[model samples]
Target: MPLANLLTSLSALPESGSRDAYLRFLKSAGDAALRRSGGPEHVTGSCFVFSPEFDRVLLCFHRKGQFWVQFGGHIESEDASVAEAAQREAREESGISDLVLLSPGIMDLDRHDLHAGFSCSAHWDVGFAAATAPDVEVSVSDESEDVRWFPINEMPIQVPAGFGARLERVRHAAMSQSGTQIG
Candidate 1:
């Protein structure tokens, strides 16, 4: 099957973060095109920073179509751990200080279909965490048009399908681990 067809099939499935299903899908999709391409899997991580004062989560509106998303990007070769890569990306992208890692390490994993002329897979291992005493200084980088906190309930409608559930799981796990109630 062509990479486009595989992507279409993957995209149609519910984004439930099921590892077994995803691995099986990848294996059956055809002999590891990702490995054969001789390029990294395009790993990325992001912190879902939440502020009690605003009762919202910090998000970045990406420049491409202004999609609201957390801070993350491709993993550099120097990075020893995915969590560290996520932390670095968040700080570099958002310029926020005193960010905290909420989850154990990696929080979510998914394969993104880059629909450029030829399709390629970008595997993401998202890391979740909270920010402390954010400085509120907005810096628009190449990746994002704007960065700000949004009330969780009033978040933009651009979020991808089934992302809400994944966010909730991360939130619940973080809250439970931190001994904080999900207000």
Candidate 2:
């Protein structure tokens, strides 16, 4: 799966805090952006999901991170698009199949240094946004220890500081995309 199109999709995003870093990854990855060997750097896809009411979001307690976080993971060979990969990961992790992306363009771009336990040295995470119906049922996946929805104001306090801040940006983006007022 060559990621030239994915690169194009990434390159089309509006200027963002992590846009430069994401563009650098796309430029450096060349045709290999979709086939990372899980070494130094890898391109990953993630989806940040919010309820249709826009008052809550879904999160999972990632076993590796031991904290509540949005659902996402590395891109796979069969994934046709970054959005597809993001939706698949979100559905798999959150057990919610009705998620709808807020936009076709990338919603958020992030670069993160991986902990020692993961195979990838670093994760160039491409984030998309999904809207879930309010009060949807959620189940914990094997990769996660817990799965639940939290009010926007009371997101669990154990997530990564960076994740929390980035989530706010995602929330605002999602809100604006759907013609809703942000916060």
Candidate 3:
């Protein structure tokens, strides 16, 4: 039911060119969109893990991409939904078990191309917002060289292009829903 869940989530998105692209990709690829073998272009689940106070966010130094990014990757066969996949990825990558979803649906969508040496041509990333206690301990996974929390106003310079703006939007959405003031 991952596909069905994804379709429902994507459908709930406000009308926009990005939403159109996601819908188009799902429509053409069908269930294959959830798997890597679907093609170079596939759906990915990611979470921007934040502190309970919303002042800091968790990012991993991806071993492959060699950059600090949110936790996420391909949607596996066992994933019940894209949100679940995002949560699972966050837990696995950050070693935090009690993260809570801040948004009811997908928080943002991103479509980006990979570098020449990577496996996929592009990733239509489905993003979610999640939070955990600020004092929780974190351990780096094998997929990352390092894992740590960064203040919302002081992200690393090595992040992907436009990551700052994307983070701001997700942060605002999460803050808005929880009735918390934006930091």
Candidate 4:
């Protein structure tokens, strides 16, 4: 049932290479892709958490990747939909439970190769955007060494490949979807 929800969500996204690829993966891998043990690639959910003002983005210094990145992880059986998975990850990793999804549909999709230390060779990441209240405190989860908010213009150097562009896309989507000014 959750996989069906994911499929519906992905299907609703506008046509794009990333969307196409995710559809293909789901068609071929079925529910297996939702689990980490699903071959070498699996679906994961992540969120670019923005401040109430939308000028700052929350990032975690991933312990394994050693880079500042958005909060996310593998989909679990408990997740009812991909967006819910993203929200769950954001809440767990950022320690901010009041995050609101910026869009009803996913904002971005990224398939990236993993480092050697990871169990999976790649992650087909479903990306979303969320906003948190001003002055909410963040506590770093066990997956990260640090969790902090950074200005949208001054992101940290140690980040995943293509993270800057990804953030820009997600930011635009978040702003437009939420009817917030793209300041």
Candidate 5:
């Protein structure tokens, strides 16, 4: 029942080819979507954090991949919802506070080949759109090499394989849904 609301929220999204697939997977797997015990694919969450004015976006240089990425990671057992997991991961990874969720449903869904030591063979990533205050400071966690904001135009050059496209989708969602917007 923990994932019931998340499944409901995801059900509200205007499904695309990829989102439809994620929904199908969730329908079939249920709570196993968030569990990693013996499975190769598991749920992960992340937020595309925007600056107050919505121009610059926050990013972290992952210690593992050594490239810039939106703040997010594996959803833990304590995470009751994918949205909460995404907000928590963004706050923890970016050191940004008072981040507001722009949408309650899944903003984006992506499947990637994850070779990270912490994850299984693949990641079924659920993303949320969030906005942070302008004056907030960022702390670089041990999992990251650095934390900083980048212009949308210059943000994609070094983003790892799956991130660039996902960020773009979140940016579009934010702009459409958040009134002002950030890319």
Candidate 6:
């Protein structure tokens, strides 16, 4: 089947009521365009990042696929807000006990190519804040291979699509709240 058609079909499926639902949502959404590419549904995920300093963010290196992504996921139920879920998922996955969910609203949705024959939908990412030193130990979870902090200007190349811009917006919001200038 064409990738886009496959993704549409996958998205139309009933939610699996598992962690996999978020993954499915991402795979379907990201690959919606791939129906034209003649591919299949791929894995879905949620990702987030933490700003530990004024100009740095924490990121995870996913073991499963070895890609760098923010902390987020698929919508689990109709009850919880996507942002709430994103924060909870990030805390669980990254073991960052001191993080705070920074909010006005969800920042953005992003889509990207996935493995095998599938594409993914917008990863519903929610950004957060932390005040720990840059080298704080990150207790890795099964979902991630490794975790580390990166300076804003020195982020990894594979940092999820749209993340840089979103982080910039988040920083601006924070700066505004603090009555400071961001340049």
Cα RMSD for predicted model 6:
10.0
Per-residue lDDT for 30-60 in model 3, tens only? 9988999999899999999988788999899
RMSD of each: 7.5, 1.8, 1.2, 1.2, 2.2, 10.0
Look at candidate 5 and give me any clashing residue pairs. none
TM-score of each: 0.70, 0.91, 0.96, 0.95, 0.88, 0.59
Better of 1 and 3 by TM-score: 3
| Higher-ranked by lDDT: 3 or 5 | 3
- Could you say which candidate leads in TM-score? 3
| Global Cα lDDT for candidate 4 | 0.89
Runs off by more than 4 Å, candidate 6: 1-48, 117-136, 161-163, 177-180
- After TM-score superposition, the amount by which residue 91's alpha carbon in candidate 4 deviates from its true location, in angstroms, is 0.8
- For every model shown, the clashing-pair count is 0, 0, 0, 0, 0, 24
- What's the lDDT for candidate 5? 0.78
Model 6 lDDT on a 0 to 1 scale: 0.53
Task: Put down candidate 6 lDDT per residue, 82-170, tens digits, no spaces.
Answer: 44555666676678776556542433334454554224422223243333456656787887888787788887887656667866766
- Give one digit per residue, the lDDT tens place, for model 1 in 20-52: 555465566443432325343433556777664
Clashes of 1: 0
Q: Is candidate 4 or candidate 5 better by TM-score?
A: 4
In order, what lDDT does every prediction score?
0.59, 0.80, 0.89, 0.89, 0.78, 0.53
Two-way TM-score contest, 2 vs 4, winner: 4
Candidate of highest lDDT: 3
Residue lDDT tens for model 4, 28-120: 999899988878999999999998678999999999999999999988878887788899998999998777687758888999999987989
Model 2 per-residue lDDT tens digits across residues 1-183:
337667678667777657777777677776566556635687778988888877888889999878888899878878888778888899999988777677867777777777877767777778889887767888888899998888888978799767777888888888888899765
Error of 1 at 101 (Å): 1.4
Q: Which stretches of candidate 4 lie above 4 Å from their native place?
A: none
Worst 10 residues of 6 by lDDT: 34-43
